[model samples]
Target: MKIPILIVMLLLLTSATSKKMWKTRYFTKHVVQQQDTWCVHACMEMSFGIPQCMALHRWLEYSQQLIFPTLNCCDLITPDNYCNCVEHGGVARSEISSFLRQQFSPISGVFTDLWDFLPRGDIVQLAFLSVRYTSTYHLVVLREVEQVEDYLWDILYCDPEVGYSTRVYNPNKLEIIY
Candidate 1:
């Protein structure tokens, strides 16, 4: 009898702790979607996070609906020899980046690849030895733009799966790089 009671208590405590952890993980101050553009609205109203990033596909769908009311979002993703909605390779990256920039002004830079689409290193200092190549690629908010350092912004994206909870660098710990 006592063993069963103890087990039940342990389970209850574990569940309570897990719930608290989840709450903190998914916590966002606000979330909003524009009538036509979801990504822009999300970035403008809410702080960028993994949850928002994960919803990229969905936002794409929503945007497609607004752009082409007749077609669905899947239609856009589907491959096409002609100029359908599907865009592959480097072209897709550039198109997506351009589309994002057109909708959002807060985004100062963007970096896209055949596989991953992200922001440029205008805000974050990356690994050495390249005037063009950037190691860390993702959107960053420009806090200051110095002539010497160029541009300064807090790191917004780290790992998409883990989600970006805070800035990549802390002024106290890291030095600013141009």
Candidate 2:
């Protein structure tokens, strides 16, 4: 009888704990989609700790409603031809921005100069990187930005093409949904 009462008390206490707690998690270890045009998909998976297949499924559903009703998102997507690959290209900034807002209302958009973004801690922003050789775009997750009032600064991010590179760029309407 006493054991049952004690177990009940413990469960109550655990349920009463604070609900507001933030923890930094690395999803790369669990799953990684090291491919082209899937940067947005990868970032989505990382932020939410979901699998690439699920993300791809959502993309297919969305694309069907918006772009092509006939094409299926689940149909085999190989490196040669992905839903948002070189053949089909990628989704637009508005599509990603709106999708994230609806999916994760906790997310907030910041469309400002990197210099002005005074980040207090590690922040994740969905960014688009222009391909140097061709008229195309790739997805990237803007992870961190460090600056000493313009004298010295650098930005870090992860992408399939670069893996993780630190370079300077004027984000072309960055869909920074944190």
Per-model C-alpha lDDT, please? 0.32, 0.50
Worst 10 residues of 1 by lDDT: 19-28
User: Judged by lDDT, which candidate is best?
Assistant: 2
Cα lDDT of model 1 by residue, 33-146, tens digit: 322223332333344343332344444554454444454433343334322332211112234445544543443234433112112233332211101225422232222211
What TM-score would every model get versus the actual structure?
A: 0.27, 0.53
Query: How far off is residue 79 in model 1, in Å?
Result: 20
Q: What lDDT score goes with residue 102 in model 2? A: 57
lDDT of prediction 1: 0.32
Q: How high a TM-score does candidate 2 get?
A: 0.53
**Model 1 stretches with alpha carbons more than 4 Å out:** 1-66, 70-92, 108-159, 164-178
Of the candidates shown, which would achieve the greatest TM-score relative to the real structure? 2
Return model 1's CA RMSD, one decimal: 16.8
Candidates in order: C-alpha RMSD to true structure: 16.8, 13.0
- In lDDT terms, how accurate is model 2? 0.50
For model 2, state the Cα shift of residue 62 in Å: 2.6
